[model samples]
Target: MRLTPFRAFDWNLRSCGLHGHVTYRPDEEPLAERLHTSTPVGEAWRCLRCGTFALGAPAAAGPADEAPLVLRGRALRDAVILRLLAAERGIRGLLLLLLAYGIYRFDGSRQALRKTLDDYLPLLKPAAMKAGVDLEHAGPVRLIEHALTLKHSTLLLVSAGVLAYGILQLTEAVGLWLMKRWGEYVAVVGTSIFVPLEVYELVEGFTWLKVGALVVNLAAVVYLVWSKRLFGIRGGHAAFEAERHAESLLAVEHAAALA
Candidate 1:
């Protein structure tokens, strides 16, 4: 018996079963020759996606310039990148929402938290003194004390702002993950707007994590603007659509026919 080696996942075939094979009939001679052949039962057209021979007349017959069954080559690569960005946006959004919720909850129960801290501080402080740690001026304790002093209205505003930022992140995530034109616009514009803020934060205190985030956002903005032709850059929407049309499987077959 012969064994077959493992094959890399084929995105083309992933949807073929559910959507049915995409078979097209090109009336032109050389293109049709490349795409279809006669079988014992009938003429079998090649599926544009999986490249399987399906017995029957083509699902649609005409020129070979029809839309593709699935994204291929550079289009597929672009899709992967978009989804990776989307995932990052999604995670950041969730974390921000949780942070906002934590602040809100802290505002409500701060007194209780302080009482608990006071109750435990005598025991903790003795250990801290032995360990050369200052319980009164420790970073976490200081932050909690400062937060306890904030006005209710101020806490409310801060929570609301964080929640709004979180929602924006989630919205961008959905758009990018769907690979919509509007989503690309949202990501580019949103990231661009916040980039200055990120820079300001980095300037205040540098951290590799912040630097990484700044770089990623900058790269995403550049990619969406230039590669996706957002705004009027790179010839705008018409050129973007034309590129997709040109990158279709049928377009390649058409070029092959000419060759």
Candidate 2:
């Protein structure tokens, strides 16, 4: 049997070796000995992240339980996913903000724009006809006409609503991009709120974009809840911390047992 060559993008491992090396010492003698060693030049300590010894004193020292639980493996994967989601939110937020600004500008200059369109539209009619284009009934022309028909108050309210939604999107982006626990909660809640609206839009008019958005939102909510163990789910905060400590403890025991 022949084995297929495989490639893997081990994010945390790469991060540890390249940029995020975490070294530590424990107060306990036996545990400390496993992590620290004598070297020709000086003392060296094992990196908690990649298990590679570093030729220097430990960056941090504390009880084994207090050692930093730097993100690794699945945790790093979670950070990458959250940041991607944050990027999506940031883009949507900016687009919504631009839309809001456009609406505000249109509301303020509705009469002038309408006058300009009316004055210029007829002048282009002959050229439009020659080019096989219906300038008067074009999408942009129809949209402008319809927007002008709306009351000023309605336009202002719509713009304000869009602006608020855009601000909310930006807030979510900040939290998720930073990978804060509160941000995860914010994203989960915010996304949950939009799921129904997305579903309604999908039901009213089926589109792949809406379907994709809906799928992403639901998946994010599930991932955050299950993996982060939020809101009393799957033993919640205590269990979450315990799991991290457990990983560190296993590493400590493995190193010490080897000695």
Best by lDDT: 2
Candidate 2 Cα errors over 4 Å, as ranges: 1-6, 119-142, 248-259
RMSD of each: 4.6, 3.3
Q: lDDT tens digits, residues 5-109, model 1?
A: 535667556656666777776667778788777887889877766677778887787765654535644565688899999999999999999999999999989
Query: Which 10-residue span in candidate 2 carries the lowest summed lDDT?
Result: 250-259
lDDT digits (tens) for residues 1-259 of candidate 2: 7765534666757887678667777888889988788988998877765566778878887787777767766677778898999999999999999999999998888889989998999999999999999998897899889899999999999999999899988899999999788888888888899888899999999989889888988998999899889998999989987898887766555545545
- What are the TM-scores, per candidate, against the unseen true structure? 0.81, 0.84
| lDDT (Cα, 0-100) at 158 in candidate 2 | 93
